[model samples]
Target: MKYGVLEAATAAAIIATSVSLLYTPPEPSWETEVVANDTYGKFVEVDSYGSNVGIAYVDSIDTGLRLAEKSYSTSITDFSAQRKGNWDTQVIDNRSETGMYPSLESKSGQPSISYQDGDLGNEKLYYANRQNGEWNRTEVDNVVGGGTSVGMYSSLNFHQSKPVIFYHSPSQGLKMAEKKQEWSKEILEDGQGWYTETSKCGNTIKVAYTGRNSEQLKIGEYDGGWSSENTSTKIKSDLDIDTDQRCDEQLAYLDTETEQITYKDQDSRTFGDAFFTRLALTSKGNTTHLVYHDEGTGLKYAKKKDGEWTTKTIKQGSETGEYNDIEIDHIGNIHTAYTSQKKVYHTVYNKGTTQKIQSKTDEVKIGLGLISALLLIFTAIRQEVIAKIIQKIGEIQR
Candidate 1:
């Protein structure tokens, strides 16, 4: 199916769901489960029909929306919906592509979705709305520089009551975009460091990235406007090392009422290699957290409970590990995904239980295969003894 047709059908379904709820409301239910994953530079959107739903990612070669559909447990039908490129193409020419990074976030309280088209030359951000079974997309910003890494290389979030974008600009440092009449303005500009990580809660934006001169990891928060830029408190710790780069970080508010930012920091332990490090706020708007790692003794968790930096390893493992991602759900559940020994793992902290999910199916299969081999060896030995008895009888007859 073409991209346009798939979106049209989805929009129709959404409209149907909305209308049905208005007329006869009942318990909330999920109509379908759709999974989107990228394979070989193509965005594959698979629907519940157990078939390939032909939805393509918008780019220069394949512009606009495409779609396909399948039935419940039935084979997917080879039908599609597509919309050809017919928008303001003169805005930017995204030809010399270095890297294309796409980030998607749904607008709060509205049926609108925003995505960033990060290309080498024409780096642009866009917002699209689904109204009455049609999609209307509008360009929000056209970032200059063919080499600048714009858009969400780290994280993207929608702040309630205000539409703001927290992203890293190669030249503009850590920047924030506020919704304006047509285009947004860059609110925070730090000359010392380049912003590498960002997350938003309400109107506050927390950023973690490498700093200038020393290249140390720094965390900052933005609120109201640029006047709040100086209010960002830097976390201090003895675990901090020079020449270390913050690869990835995630921020979440500890308490929704207090609006405190609790973030995880990944720092380079070696001169060239990096490891996972935990940090938390000591006080409201204060910098630094209790810091520790798992490789030393036990599971490590650091927190700034009152007004001092504390460090303690909470859970310890023999092997070294690094945190890949961290998310705090609506119910104060901390979900952390990490990597250990080239295997992806997840740990969820909720209701005082830490459930560890690991990828060890391959090892289990190998153990079963070894046991089967031993059984086969025992059967073959019995057959050999029977053959030897038959040979002795033939010798007596000769």
Candidate 2:
């Protein structure tokens, strides 16, 4: 009777501890830790090479675009005279509007950019490359709008040692250009392409664009003819590429090979407004990293690994993630740049960080672990007693 009571008590104690621990709230896995700042962003973009991270942004006062180039190894050594921090600043155009739609990438470990020459009547697309310590600006294409300004969005990528660009013009809908000493142009679509983005994902060209209405989100490829990879049309989504593909904008990734589009964060609600809600993507191998802000959810990051998507909140303070951009290094580390409270800040993914979670599955796992341990202990103790009792019974029978 005493042994039975003791075993029951042991089991109960284990169960109670397991329950309590399981119920304990998970520690917050993230905090809004800023790495650098003072660079303003109306349109902020972040990208990385190996471990080096760079940012490009444009503010109202920027006659030219701004570049913030820093590495995880070095401190802010040289501060930009324009920006308060130590960023390698470049006077991209100095002409008014040249810096309006700034986008960035790394080439051979140096920064390259594509921006609209937003100088009034010359709303053309320009590519800026740095070679031998000088920025050589090339006019990729001239959008004919006669000064009304149409190249509002421009994205850049490199494929096969050549530059690929995507931009929008009122006359040209969504246009893509490739540079090989000279530029070749093609129009992906006819309507206005709002917030269009293009990138090189392992030789595959992925273009993500919002429509003129700012509601529709569409992804496609820029091959011989532009092929629709995926589309998201919400109740009010502005762009319509497909009648079947449906969802709100939170996170969307394009798998170039399979032409599969994975959309995530549909449960998000706009607490107020996801103003400047932009998404940026960078890929490493089969995994793609996406960063964007949901109206109510603040800044969020996600990566598709082994065909599953897992997301984590970088900031929960509402209305953040605006103009958010993300990059992953060759080593698979993640870096992000975003705007909040009128300031531009940067953050990186820390695997050591504990993520706060309240999950039923977690509780079940804890409970199961305790039960398994208890069962092992009980079986070991009973094995000897059971053998002795069986032997005594045999003796009596004899």
Candidate 3:
């Protein structure tokens, strides 16, 4: 005598109920802090050096460029990893409507920022560096006349210890400004250079940007000289680029037509799925990490290692991951800055298994394991009962 279909269905229902009652999802293993509040972080960039993390962002309330710096303790003995010492905020530039689209980098434990001036008739590019307890500002480039903007899409990096900035010019195309003695400028492409991102590997400085005419992806490499090439990939809203120690380029971009987050390396391999604009990317050796906004599921952190991609949601909200920036520290911790509801937030992911929080996928796996074990036991008991019934019947017949 075997179990009927209704009995099987009831057993499945019981197993499901048992799993639901017995298993609990682990808590998220990340911590977040509010860096700024109430429209202070419109456009942001984050960078880390040693134990210090710095964020540069546009404070829309004061219409200024702001810097937020915090130092984190890396000791895991006390479980006090999220103890980011008080975030100190400083006004880098507060003139009339400045500091839109800022790129920040930490050099020698100090923050250096490149930004766009938003004042009317002063759509200029500016750089600010902190030294001796004060900030020194320099005008890197400016529009000669009144009708054009020159620095909105600026990407800043250091090449040979000198600051090099790649920026967009509405009338002039893609341009680069290098600060050796005085700021010298050169035009890379005549009618291109939108949404530029820059990274350095030894003496090589690479920039990834969007072409103005075709709206496609383009790469500009600067070793001894500048050379430009076009890629078949199209750019939609935003993109980021980084380089590993091997000088291999790791790039992530928003696809023009699909609105998907597409990643590519020097070898031209691609990964990722549908996501919204404004992502940040960083790489170390064979591991690449990205933080992007998913239109359906909020903010996500994705990692690609050994040719496989594993992604997890960092925060869940409609507008959480917009305007995000990511950085990897020397010891392999991940730090990110993002904006949600017009406020800036900082989050960190520390490496190691010290934290016991499991992801949602892990919870599902645990539930499935429980169900499988229970189903095996139910089948084994049912078969034993059937064997006993047949034995009794055969004994009576004898």
Candidate 4:
């Protein structure tokens, strides 16, 4: 009877221990925070300027969606009021408007500001500087046709210690213009032929966009001259080629490590549901990190640590949202902002801690399950022994 009672108590204890282990609350972890309102738009740059960090976005305001700036520290402030409007607006208004707005580029070592002028066309580039809490605008490129259409893209690269702007004109293919000797030179004469997205890594320029007749993502390298390659093996019809296919591509580098490009391709009917591709290539002293986004899966990242594409998903599901802008700081920290359900959200990945925790949780769950099974087997053996003893005792008593 005593042996049976002890066995029963052991089983109860094992069951209770298993229940406690399984029901414990998960440890809290860092999660992406919704920093702004539910607005559909683009967040161009998050500049760590002045005494705090300033975020810039190009979205609809009173006179339609224009570029705006907001400053945040421990507190958030609308610095947009200090600026008249976005760079596009200033160019449209003939550069007469004043105040702080958004600019494609800012003069280095100056309080960042947006510039605009009437002499500039709809496609204009301006250099802005802030003096004594006020903004000064200067026209960097008076040339016409630099801006991309809505949902399209363009980029400015400070290559070889010179500012070069690469953009797609409506009918012109990919064009490269260098700001040298206070004069601009159109290097790529065959400008508007294929879709093009350009980014700079150190001194290397990486351009990726779709081809004129094919859906493949065409990539180009600019060292001394322009050399091109196709990153995607799929055909042109397999991808979603925009009206002006030349402008739909996106390109960016991962920190200062290496250049990478991410763009949309529609291989199947499932492709149109996915619109944006965020890619990053990072080289640790010389390592490459490639990250991309697909409609089927939200955010996918790849790394070249030992010299292969080691890929993983950062986020999954459409609920995570789309239209992501990724930036890697000097210290190799990644910050991404995207629109999910019409709301702007920001997420930062710090040294892969999130990845480590997820791995541990998976392993722990498996280990717990195995332990529970072992306990169950032991409990069964004990119960069987107890039953045998009880039977023997009854026999003896009879």
Best by lDDT: 3
State each candidate's clash count. 29, 9, 0, 24
Measured against the true structure, the TM-scores of the candidates, in listed sequence, are 0.38, 0.62, 0.78, 0.50
Clashes of 3: 0
What lDDT does the true structure give each of the candidates? Answer: 0.36, 0.60, 0.79, 0.44
lDDT of 1 by residue, 76-184 (tens): 1201111222211111223333113322233432333344565545676555544554556666556662125555332344455545555555555555665655546
Encode model 2's per-residue lDDT on 172-251: one tens digit a residue. 67777788778887777777467676645455666667656444567776554568644544322211111112222234
lDDT of 3: 0.79
Model 4 TM-score, 2 decimals: 0.50
Per-candidate RMSD, Å: 21.9, 10.2, 10.2, 12.2
| TM-score winner, 1 or 3 | 3
In TM-score terms, candidate 1 sits at: 0.38
Candidate order (TM-score) = 3, 2, 4, 1
For residues 1-398, could you state the per-residue lDDT of candidate 4 as single tens digits?
35564566566657655764665323322235554565434333443333223344433332212233332222112211112222221111222322112324333533343322222244444544456655555465434444432112345556776666554444455666665687364535343323344555555776655544444456666775778765534322111121112322232322111122323222111112334443333334333444445567675555544434455566676645344544443434345555556555555544333334445656766676666676677777877898999999999999
Candidate 1's C-alpha runs over 4 A off are 1-118, 125-139, 143-147, 152-160, 190-203, 206-208, 212-221, 228-323, 337-398
